[model samples]
Target: MVETGNRYMDNVSKLISWGHWFSFINILFALVIATRYLVAADWPPSLLGQGYMLVSWLGHFSFLGFAFYLLLIFPISFLVPNEKAMRLIAVFIATVGTTTLLLDTQSFTLFNFHLNPLVWNYLFGGEGPQATNLLFIAIPFIFLLQLTASGLIWRNLKTLHQKKLGPVIATSLFVAFLLTHTIHIWADASYYRPITMQKANFPLSYPMTAKTFLIRHGWMQQNEQEKSNRHTHPGREIKYPLRAIEVNQPQPKMNVLLVMIDALRADMLNPTNMPALSQFAGSASTFNHHFSGSNHARLGIFTTFYGLPSQYWPDISDAYTPPILMTQLQQAGYQFGLFSGQGFLQPEHMQTSFNSIEQLNMAEPISPVYDGDTQAVKQWQQWLNQQNNNGAPWFSYLYLNTPTGMEVPPEFDGPHQPTSTMLQAQQAGPESLIKGLFNDYQNAVLFTDQQLNRVFTTLAQLSALENTIVIVTSAHGQEFDDTGNNNWGHQSNYAWAQTQVPLVIHWPGKTPIQVDKDTSHLDIVPTLMQGLFETTTASRYYTSGLNLFGPLKRDFILLGDEENYVVYQADRITEFTPKGNAYVLDRNYHELENAEPDIQVLMKVLNELRRFYPNN
Candidate 1:
């Protein structure tokens, strides 16, 4: 019996030793995996930026990983108090953690941003059968991968129980993580050197509030805090609530028609290219210095609807942020007809913008469908003609994406023959090719004007123009390498070429006039609300926009994109970037290298922006 007992003890010792070896192997394996994440691009714009990115990547990820190990995984391994049981728990945790990390890597590759609520909402929220089928197909492969990771983790944990080196290595990793993470956050806050901000959406990142702290201490400008706040959601307490709208006078029941031509630059509305629109603008109220709420379509549309900036999208989306605008219109019995060139009411949550919206199922044909601005417009015309004259006021939204896609009928494609097509022109680096691209964009505008003429003629034929308030604008403007750094897209920059768009309002009883005061897309909904309801001018202050007929709110206006926020006042424009970079430019979009900033104007603009977000 004694000899048998000794033999059993000897076997147990061998098993424990084997477990230790396996644990060491997994530690090495995990290190290799971590190293893959630590690797970065060699071509950072600056040496400081390169170092900041590297340290931030290593420190933030490593620290986060070590924290999980110590707080969650390690406790589970030792708390069980049974060698075999502890090993089982440890293996399970390690497998899950490893799988999550792998999945994150794959997600980062697929989308520039990290895995977040937005991605999940897009993937599984409404994709229906496709998302389900994809999950079904992936389950088997994921299960096999998990099993393989579990086997490795089991061996690793068994071996780790026999050694003290595990704790020592973990301590070393934790220390390194702390050092790098501190440097990353501090640099971002103090120097505005966007170290970790390049990956601001990295999984589980703590929001950076150090900039606010710095501002309070008088160590840094409040500009950083303002820009940061633009990305945050508003609180539960609504800033702009439903106030009783006091009307100035009695008004007739009128129909409102909004026609948005995508990427129509303010300078491009000419007698030559867009003759029809030019002729209409000549007799309408045109804002010569109008700017888009944002440089991109999604945010621009969000601003137009909410009468606020894009930062409010998340919170506002959760519950109707400013439900009063649309609800009031609906209550007043305004029939709505919403049309879009591309898919509208998407991201699902934005459906709140309209009360019972109807969409047209029209595809963009390869060839021009008879000089039409968009298939949606043609469908809308047909739908409009069929509606019974029920004497109810109506609101119709017509969106045309012509200059955006730069597509036109072959009949209208003459006068701007380029050396290459749009796709090739984008890659062709010559100045002439860039000019050719701009020419194509202009030709597209002309084609859209022709299509608008059809809509105008139809309205005239139906006598709808007599009582209709026609408002023409755009979601945002486009770029054609106008900035000289190969910036050929709308969302790429916040320069005048990308933010400036024309706004033309043709009120039935109002006379034609050109307004040079700076205006924005935010003013559209408020203007419509006031005009439709005959609200007093003072009520416009409730919105972020000023009444076109009232005094200007301030000298400057705030505009933004996903990556940039800008303040434009007078001829000088100030752009604030996520990486803490700020620059001033003249009206011509030329960088004013040594020009002194208008601090007063900048602060006023920033203060207005801070009102939208509570935290800043």
Candidate 2:
């Protein structure tokens, strides 16, 4: 019995040695397959970046292949001690793994993103087999290759073990892995573009960052305020506009004033809630069915100015490229007076939208919400006077933050009763709390309308209302537990309560008519470019929007920030998260478990996301 036990131990040791050799060969296979990712990625410009990319490519896949062996095949080798059984199991595992890698590479190349369970279901579920038949065809060949490799490695196991190069190769790979991570840490801290930009190039790659760690350990010191003030610039090249803009300036260039109210819901604009604004809308071109490009403030504003989807915000912001509209206005000799109740530093609009403007006002009054709103309006009035004296076509942007803060002056009377403070509402029961919170929101909107009245009164008094083109809209709509899933605020979903905002445009010499068709903030820039400047350039050249006055209607719209977005069709919304998870929901935000994404809409969305890049 003791002899038999000793023999079993000897067999286990030999199987482990054979497993190591098998894993080494598979690592080589994985490395060769992973080259597809490098090809799909934007190549690093620096020599050091190129070297790091190669080293990381070699090390990452080698580590993954070895890890797979240890976790799945190493234990199986002992359970089934026979060499033939081990080879069959290893081949099957390897084939499945290799096939998955191949599928991921294809998905990444086409979509500029990787695959997850949702994407996998889309690829192999339902009619997906028809779309991915070619990839499936390669599976049998992969199995045969893995099988042949397993057999060769098994037959030559003793010879490979005798050579004893395993330790050298393993050490080299481990060193490469460590060196890549160390380089990423330094690159991230120093804001080194070449290496830092490659962070998302590799699938399942999350490089280390040491900014907070270094600060905590006293190795680095950075001013918190200055860091917050700094804007993010793009790490890669992007061709915004795709080409130079050509436009014929209108004979009598109208002064444009765009007023954006924070968290203003479309439904709240009525005789009861916002009397002054409701009256203003009656004489302007009011869009009853309108949506902001995103539920988030930054992206919503970005979309309005750039006339592009929110996904491009990061690239545009990072590149410090002002929108085509702003540049055109500048070239037409329009003076700019930009004011935000909430300072532009947080979203860093000073670095993005108003980047080209000289002597920009980045300061907002440090006071109560009511005082801030009052001051912003006063500043705009003063600026308008100065512009009128200069006799140049002027463009003014006034952003109010009253409704978002849900605060009003104590002296002011609110029509909405039984309203609780935001904190009080938060502490109340969920069902009862929403009503009170919503009441508070209504009162805030009422106060914001009063400020709007002041602007209108000033324009009329100066007789500028006839020549000035005024646009009243919101950056994004607010939410108050409208989804019933305990979603209390914006950025939670792309539901109507968060995306639908009031859009009332007072274009000079144009008929004031209510537009009931689907429209978006994205249409704003394109409208100004065509209607005001008479630009003959096609809308597709610089924007993903149609002219607001155009007869063509959009069949669908997109809403979200950089990491997550939803494609809103007529009856359904397909939401996608950063992790590649997707959910098909009805118009009411209820998930439809059996529903599939509309392929046509998704294809259009994918095209828009990639078209603005340097190379298609």
Candidate 3:
């Protein structure tokens, strides 16, 4: 029995040796095939970027080959211990892997996106089979090549082992892999565009980020890290507007006052929670079915100013390009007064929306967001009074965050009963705690509403209400486990509770009509461009949105952050992740088994996302 066990162990060892040699050969093959990806992607302009590209390519594919060997061949070596059966299985696995890689490369080359279930269904579902048949023909050739290589590696395993080059090759690959991650960490911390921009070039490549680690060790400061994350590469170029904006100056230039409340949910605007804002909405052109461009303040505000999807954020922010809306406002001689409860440095709005404004007020005050809200309101009121005296049409942006912080002053009693503090609710479990937290959110909203009413009263006192275009809306909606899935905050999902917000537009001459049509924060820019500036430029040139007051109809709403987005239809939501994978969920965000999105709508969405780029 001992002799038999020794023989079996020897066989397994030999098979393991053969597997390494096989993996090495396949790694070469994979490297050759992966060149397709390099050819398809935008080559880096810098020498460092090119060096990173080469090393990452070598390390990534080497890792994949060894991973496959460990996962598939290593187990089989012990189980089967038969060279011929192992060779056949190995060949089959290699063939399938290679074929999948080939298909992904092709997909990436054509679409600039990798293969996912949604893309697979779209590529092979209907008439796609006929178009893709030519690509499928290469699978047999791949299988034959893998089979021949597997047999050759097995036959020469002893000679390869005697050569003893495996250790040297393995060490080189390990070094290359380690170097790749190290360079990525440095590049991410430094915000090196040439290196950082290639983050999504390879599929499933999640390179290491050292911002937090460096900050912990005192290698980097918190403010420096925030700037690094938000700073866009100035080297990159984009065609924003696609053409120059032509504005026919209005007869009487209208002042625009855009009031954005943080974490103000649509449901919180009722008579009970926010009586002041609800009463204001009754007189203004209120939108019942309105959505923010994103579930977070940063991108939501970006979409409002840029009139574009969040996908363009990186490119636009990288260039430090102000939105066309802001540029138009500046050119039209609109004086700017921007105030935010939360500092703009964190989101780097000063680098994007307010990039062109000289000496902009980025924030009012920092701690206890309630105090910041009060200061912001006071500052805006003072600015509005000054603007009333000046003849120039002024633009004032007041961003309040008291509701987002869930804070209220001690003097003002919260009418909502059974309310728990944010800390109390967070420490407790998620059953009835969500209800108490929600009541707390209502109290916060009520406090914010009172602040907003102060602005309206000031406007009425100065008689600026007749000439100012006062638009009240939230940056994004706050969530409170409305779906009962423990989703208690924004940026978690694209559900109604997180995306929906109230839009009350008090246009000077427009009738006070309640609009039930679907609208977005994106529409704000286009509406202002058409109404105030009287710009003849078509909305499509710079915006993905239509005029909110002009024949508003939408088949779907596109809402998301930088990496992932959801195409929200009336019945179902199709969420696309960073990897391009699609998840079909019902209205309440419950996963719907075997459901797919409308292909036409997805096609339109893809176009909308890519249209702003220089070459689409």
Query: Which digits, one per residue and each the tens of the lDDT, describe model 1 over residues 1-616?
Result: 0124565454444344434443444444445554544442222334555565555555556655556655764545434445556556655655566556554544443333345443344445563226333544654564565456556655564455556576686566566566565665565564433343354534565634465676778887665653453224122223554355565533438888888777888888779888888888888899998888888777777777667766555445534454455656666777877776564545321434652344433344323422344677787788678652677777787778778877666656557667247547368667767677777778788878887888788888888887888888887888887777678768877877888898888888887788888998777767776777876645534567766765666777878854466888787888765433467888767889877555455445545654644323
Model 1: residues >4 Å from true position, as ranges? Answer: 1-238, 242-252, 318-324, 348-352, 355-373, 411-413, 422-429, 578-580, 612-616
lDDT (Cα) of model 1: 0.63
**Cα RMSD to the true fold for all candidates:** 18.4, 3.3, 4.3
> Which stretches in model 3 have alpha-carbon errors above 4 Å?
1-22, 42-46, 70-89, 110-116, 127-131, 147-174, 191-193, 209-213, 225-237, 250-252, 341-343, 362-367, 418-436
How do the predictions measure up, each by TM-score?
0.60, 0.92, 0.86
RMSD of 2: 3.3
- By lDDT rank, best first, the candidates go 3, 2, 1
- lDDT for each residue of candidate 3 in 286-397, tens digit (9 for 90 to 100): 9898899999888889989998988778778877888888887777778888887666664437768888888676444578888888988887888888888878988888
lDDT of 1 at 108: 42
| Stretches of candidate 2 exceeding 4 Å from the true structure | 1-6, 44-50, 124-131, 185-200, 209-212, 221-233, 250-252, 421-433
Pick by TM-score: 2 or 3, better one? 2
Q: Clashes in each model (backbone N, CA, C under 3 Å)?
A: 5, 2, 1
lDDT of candidate 2 over 298-396, digit per residue (tens): 888999999999988866776688999988888787888888766676543765787888867667544687788898999899988877787888889
Model 2 backbone overlap count: 2
lDDT, candidate 2, at 262? 84
